[model samples]
Target: MNNPIVLNAFRFVLLLLAQVLIFNGLNFMGTINPMVYVIFLYWYPIKENRAVFLLVAFLLGLLIDIFSDSLALHTLAILTAAFARPFIMRFCFGVNYEFQNFTFKNTTKIQRITYLALLIVLHHTIFFCFEILSFSHILLILKKILSTSLLTIFLCTLFSSLFSPKSE
Candidate 1:
């Protein structure tokens, strides 16, 4: 059998490089960017250690921050998503869901979308909140959150639908 742990590590590296080297540069609409890179965290094996999850999240965010030069908001957003992952997974898979086998191929598209939607919203929420900590302009924050979330959802859904395995 393939070692899932090693496979995930390999995935992490490949995805990170893709995000940093290519995706980050593709500004779709000025500021409404689609960060599909965070999907790595979203797809991480639920059975893995929480500490490892958080550490990986922090490092992932750090890399984005370094590459994007954006005041660590990416790290903060990813870490928040990491922290909330268990709860999200539980909601998506039910309380009895097995983490090791959680996957889009095994679930309905709606279930997958719901799971990803919540995390995408949560991630953008945390990210923009930090971006607007001063709370100086309510309108701008609302606009950014809404626009970014919409764009991100569209892109993530597109990618998930395209790449998800054909069969379990």
Candidate 2:
């Protein structure tokens, strides 16, 4: 059960199911969609191969796109977030991120929250931007980004805390 591949595969299936079956149905005021699947990117091992991570990210997003029927919006947004993850880690964790031994468990609450918020916001921004595809509806795009990001961030933080291994 401790195998990384097995664990990640389980997580991928679980999150994809949750997103498609549960979160996809939730549309608060027809704006918010809690994309908790992005947590896969957050929880992925920092030391793992970047190409593999990106490939996993692509598959995750593509599946979401297929399920949601939103064209390639989710694919584009998730790929961008995955690509930007290292820079976001550097910004949030500072020198700590450079260490090979770094883990989210070792970071302060503020650092972890900042990292999650940035990723959620970045993903939402790209999603809504391409989704709307119009600066004429810029207000709509910004509103969707803010609302969705908040809900997604909260769910992601909760899931992370609930599932993270305890430091006995």
Candidate 3:
């Protein structure tokens, strides 16, 4: 699993299954769903070509859209977040991002959390925004985005801490 390629491939499958089979059903208060699949994009090797990375991000979201029947909502949100990922990485990790993959071993805990939190918020914000195309439900959409982002961010941060290796 240390092999980055093999690891990310497994993540794709694992996260897709988890998203569709598990988290998809765990909607809280009928409005919040934890998006664990975005973790794949978060942890992909930084050295890979940027174009390919964006393609993978779009395809990953498209896969979820297919299963969840959310049309292009997932694809749009995930792609946006994926496109913004490099910028966010630079913001969070700065020069160290050029030298290594995004991982817990090299990055500080707060930085890792901030990185994931920002992406989650972006993803959820876009997701809820598209979901409510009309201003009629502005309040509801805002509420969903806020609550869902918070829950998803917390879970993502916890997952990062639990699964990512600590620095030696």
- Top TM-score prediction, candidate number: 2
Candidate 2 regions with alpha-carbon error over 4 angstroms:
none
What is the lDDT, from 0 to 100, of the residue 134 in candidate 3?
A: 81
Residues 1-168 of candidate 3 have per-residue lDDT tens digits of 667678778888888998999999997888578888877777777788999888989889999999999999999999999999989989998877776454557667788788888898899889988988889999998888888888888877777667774332
Ranking by TM-score: 2, 3, 1
- Regarding TM-score, does 1 or 3 come out ahead? 3
Of candidates 2 and 1, the better by lDDT: 2
Best by lDDT: 2
lDDT against the true structure, per candidate, is 0.79, 0.89, 0.84
Least accurate stretch of 10 residues (summed lDDT) in model 1?
A: 159-168
Q: What is the number of backbone collisions in each predicted candidate, taken in the order shown?
A: 0, 0, 0
Query: How much is the lDDT of residue 108 in candidate 3?
Result: 75
Please give the ranking of all candidate structures by lDDT, highest first, separated by commas: 2, 3, 1
What is the TM-score of candidate 2? Answer: 0.95
Q: What is the lDDT of residue 25 in candidate 2?
A: 89
Which tens-of-lDDT digit does each residue in 68-164 have in candidate 1? 8889999999999999987897898786566556555666778778889889889988888887886777778788888878887888788766765
Q: What is the TM-score of each candidate against the true structure?
A: 0.86, 0.95, 0.90
Q: After TM-score superposition, what is the CA distance of residue 156 in candidate 2 from its true location, in Å?
A: 1.1
